[model samples]
Target: MNYYSHNIGDYAQATTHLSLVEDAIYSRLLRRYYAEEEPIADNMTQICRWVGARTEEEKEATAQILTEYFQLHEGYWRNKRADAEIAAYHVKAETAKANGKRGGRPRKEAPFSEASYGGTAGNAGSSENPPETGSQANQEPGNKNQELKETSPSPPTRASGFDASTIDLPDWLDRDEWCSWIADRRARRKPVTQEAARRQLQQLAAYLAEGHQPGAVIANSIAGGYQGLYPPRVQARPGPSASRAQRLADWTDDLRDVLASDRHPREKFMGTIDATH
Candidate 1:
C-alpha cells in the first residue's frame, strides 16, 4: 500500500479531493496538532464551538472539519516508528529456514524449575516461593508484567481524557462547552450558585473545542458559565423507635441462622463462608 493509504487522515490531508466539510476538518486538525500545539480532538470541538451551527447545516460543517482533522500527514506517518528490528529479525529467520541450513541453536532460557532452584530437595513438600535470582532481584513490576503498562501514562481514572457522562451535558450548546463540563465535573462533585451557571456555558464551549484545540477548549470551558446537575439530597427522618437503637441494631442476632448453600449457585462459590456475611 502507498504511504497515503496507511492512514485515512493522511490521505484526506494530502489533497483537497474531499467535500468542503471534509476539507474544513482536515485543515483544523493539521493546524491544531502541527501548526498550533493542540490535540486533534480538541481542535475539532473548538471548530464546533466557532461554527456554532445549531441546525443540520451547522452540524454538517462541524463533521467536515472532523473528517479532515483525522487525516494524518505524510511526515507523521514517516515519523512513526514500526520497530524495524523486529521485522528485520523475522525476515532473517524466515530466510534461514527457507535455505534448509542449520541457522543457529536457540539461546538457553533461565531455568525456573522448582527442583533446580531451591536450596534443599525435601522442603519441596511445602507450598511457598523460592529465593529470587540476581536477574529477578533486579527486575521490577514493569520488567515482568504479563501485559506492558504504558510508562508515564495518566491513570485509568483520567488519561488522554475521561468520559464525562456523570455531568450529563445539554445538547443545545456546541462542542467547546461539552468537553469542559465533563472535565471539571469529575474534579468537583457539585456546583453551587451563579459560579455554577457560569461554569456551565464555559464548560460547554470547552467541550466544543476541536481535537487540535483541546487546550484552547479547556481554557474556554474554564472561563465560561456552566452548571453541573446534582441530585437533591433528601434528609432521612427518625421513625418511631419500635425498639431501642441498640435493640434495633441487634436484630441480626435474633434472626435464626439458615444454611441454604444447597439452594443457590452463589453458595457453591461461597463454600465455607456461605453461612456468614
Candidate 2:
C-alpha cells in the first residue's frame, strides 16, 4: 500500500488532544505500519528506535499513542482502521490486475441514428439535386464563373483555445456547480485548460477520499473566490451564548482534558486555560 486515505476530519477529531511530539510519533508509526503492511512489533525499544523517539518525553508519547490507538495482538500491535485500509488496497489491486488480464475496459460505441446521416450523401454529392446542378455545377472547368466561385473562401473561425465541454466530470460532482466554477474562472480572466482541469479533478477526488462532500468542497472554493480547491478549515469561533470554558475546550483538546480531570492542581489548570487564550 503506497498510499492510504487520511480523513482530515476523522483524524483531527481523534488526535486533537495530542501534543506536537505525540502527533509526530503517531504519524511516523502509521507510516511504518502502511509501508510494511503488517502489525507493529510488540517492542517499545524497537518502536522508539524506528520512529527516532530519543528523549524521555518522545518515548513516553510514543507509548501513549500506541496504547490509545492500537491493540496488542498475540505479539504485535494492530490498528483496525489501518488493517481495513490495507485489505481494501489489496482487493483493489487484484481487481485492477484482473482487468488488465482481460485487456482493460471496452470503449462505449455511439448509438446508431440514421436521421443524422440519411440526407448527407444526397445533399452533398447527388447530381439529381437541382441546387447542386444549377449555375455553379453546370459551368465549364476553366470558366470565369467557376473561377469566381472557387475564389470565394469560407468565413474564418475564432478559436477560444479552451473548451469547457470537453471536461468529463465525475458522477459525484454536481454538474451545475462545476459549470459555475468554470464560469467563475473565465470571468476572473483565468480560464481552465485541459491540464488544470485534470489536476482540479484529482484534488477533488482526494478530498472525497477524506470523507468531504464533493458539493461542499467545491462550493467552499467558489465562495472564497479562490483559484484552487482546498480542504475546509475548522472554524473555532464560539457562539455569543457559550461560556469561556466551552470556547477554550473547542480551541484546545488538551484544555478539555485538563478541565475534566480533578487530578491536576488548580494552578496548573488555570495556567493551561490561560496559555491557550
Candidate 3:
C-alpha cells in the first residue's frame, strides 16, 4: 500500500510528549512499515539507523515510541493499526482488479411506459377514429394547425465508473449525479474504485439520514472536488432568541439616548441630575 489513512487527532494525542526529531522518526518508520507491508526487524541498531536516530536522546525517544505503540513478536515489531489498514487496502485492491476483469459496471435501464412511446392510451386501435388525408391526419385533434410532435428518446444514463458487479448501491443516491461526480473525479486523476464508492455511499447515507439535503451534500463534494463526502463545517451562529435579546438591548440603548436628549427637557434634566451624582 502506497498510502494509508492518518488521523491527526489520534497522532497528536499519541505523540504529544515526543520531541520534534522523535516525531519525524516515528512518522518515517510508519511510512516504511506501510510501504513494506510488514513489521520492522527487532534489531535496535538497525532500527535506530533506519530512523536516523544518531543521538542518544533521539535513540531513546524512538525506542520509547516504538515500545509504546508497537508490539514485538517473533523478532519483529508491528503496529496493529497499520497492519489492519494495510490489510484493508489489499482487499480493496484485489476486489477492484477482479471488477476490472468483469468489464466494469452495467448500465441502468429505464422502465418502459406508454407515454415514452409518444401516443395516448386510446389512440391505438380505435375503430371510431376515421382516417384523414395529408396534414389533418398528421395533426393532433383540437389543434389542427399544430402537427403531432414525436416523442424524443430519453437521454442516455451516465456510467457509474465503478464495477456494479462488486458493489450493491442503495436507491437513495441519484445514479446520474453519482456517475457524473465519479467521472469528474476520474478526469481530475482521482479515480475511485467500487470499494471506495461503496464506502462513500455509506458516509453520504449517514449524513442524509441526519436530515441533510442530499443535493447540498453532493454539491459541496463537487464544488470542493473531494472524492468522499464529509459533514459540512457549520459555524456557530446566534439563534433566534439570542438575536431577539440583542435587538432588545439595542432598542433599550436607543430609548435611553432619546430620554437623555434635550428634546425631552424633563427626562434630560433627570439624566443630568443622575450623572451629577
Candidate 4:
C-alpha cells in the first residue's frame, strides 16, 4: 500500500510519554512496517541503526515503545492495527479496480409512471396532422419533451448507489450533502465512484463513532480539499480566554493603585495621578 490511514488521536495518545527522538523512531518503524507490509525483524542493533537511534537511551526508548505497542510474531515485531489497516486498504483497492474494469456505475435512470404515459398519449392523438414517415410516426412531439426531461444532465451516479444504512453515518448527513460532496469531488477531476465513496464513508463513520464531530470533519475535508476524510485539526489552545483574564487582572491592579495614590479623588478618577510621587 502506497498510503495508509493514521488516526492523530490514537498516535498522540500512544506517544504521549515518548520523547521527540523516541517518537521519531517509533514513527519511522511504523512507516517501515506498512511500506514493507510485514513485521520488522526482532534485531535491536539493526532496528536501532535503521531508525537512527544511536544513543543507548534512544535505543532503550525505542525498545520500550515497540514492546508496548507491537508483538513478536514469527521472530518479527508486528503492529496489529497497522496490519489491519493495510489489509483493509488492499481490499478497497482491489474492489475499486474490479469496479473500474466493469465500467463505472451506471447512470441513474428516471422512474417511469402511468401518469406520464397517459399525458404522452393524450398529447399524441390531439395532433390532427400526424407525421407521415415511419420515423416521424415514432417521434411524437410531446415525446421529445419527455425524453429531454428524463435525460437532463445531473450528477453522475455511482455504479452502486450510496446507501446510508450500509455505514453508520451521523444522522445529520443526508443524501443531498453526500451527493453534493461527490459532485464536488468529480468536478475536481477525482476518480470518485460509489464504491470509493462507500469506503470513505466507512472511515468517516469510524471517526464519528470515536466521538469526533461530523460537521467539523466534513468542513475540514472541504476546506483542505482532501480526497479522503480525516480527523479535524487539533484545536488551538484557549489563548483568548487567558489573555482576557490577564487584562482584567491588570486593570484591577491599576484601579487599586489609583485609589491608593495621594492625588485628589477627581484627579485620580480622571487618570492624572502620578504613582511615583
Give lDDT tens digits, candidate 3, residues 1-277.
Answer: 7677788987898789977887898898999899899899999999998888898988898888789878999999987667656645654675668778987776555645555334458765444556677887666454532322333355668556464333544445566767666777778777776557656665565566455555577676677555566444453444555565555565565454445332342221112124565
What ranges in model 3 sit over 4 Å off?
106-277
Assess candidate 3 and give its lDDT: 0.66
- Write model 2 residue lDDT over 142-162, tens digit each, in one string: 474465566656555644576
Q: Give per-residue CA lDDT, model 1, range 106-192, as digits (tens).
A: 345454455533334677645376555676766643463423343334334412322333333333333554455555755665433
Q: What is residue 91's positional error in candidate 2, in angstroms?
A: 1.0
Better of 1 and 3 by lDDT: 3
Model 1: what TM-score?
0.18
Q: Which 10 consecutive residues of model 2 have the lowest summed lDDT?
A: 262-271
Count clashes in each candidate, considering only residues at least 3 apart in sequence or on different chains: 63, 0, 0, 1
Among residues 3 or more apart in sequence or in different chains, the pairs in candidate 2 whose N, CA or C atoms overlap within 3 Å are none
Report the C-alpha displacement of residue 241, candidate 3, in angstroms: 29
What are the models' TM-scores? 0.18, 0.40, 0.41, 0.42
> Model 1 lDDT vs. the true structure?
0.40
List residue ranges in candidate 4 displaced over 4 A. Answer: 106-277
lDDT of 4 by residue, 1-277 (tens): 6787788998898789988887898899988898898789999998988898887889888898789888998899977677556655554665567668878667567666534543455575544554466777567656867886877778765345443333333334565556556666667767565566557765655555465555566666666566666566453343444565555565565454445432333322222346897
By summed lDDT, the worst window of 10 consecutive residues in model 1 runs over 77-86
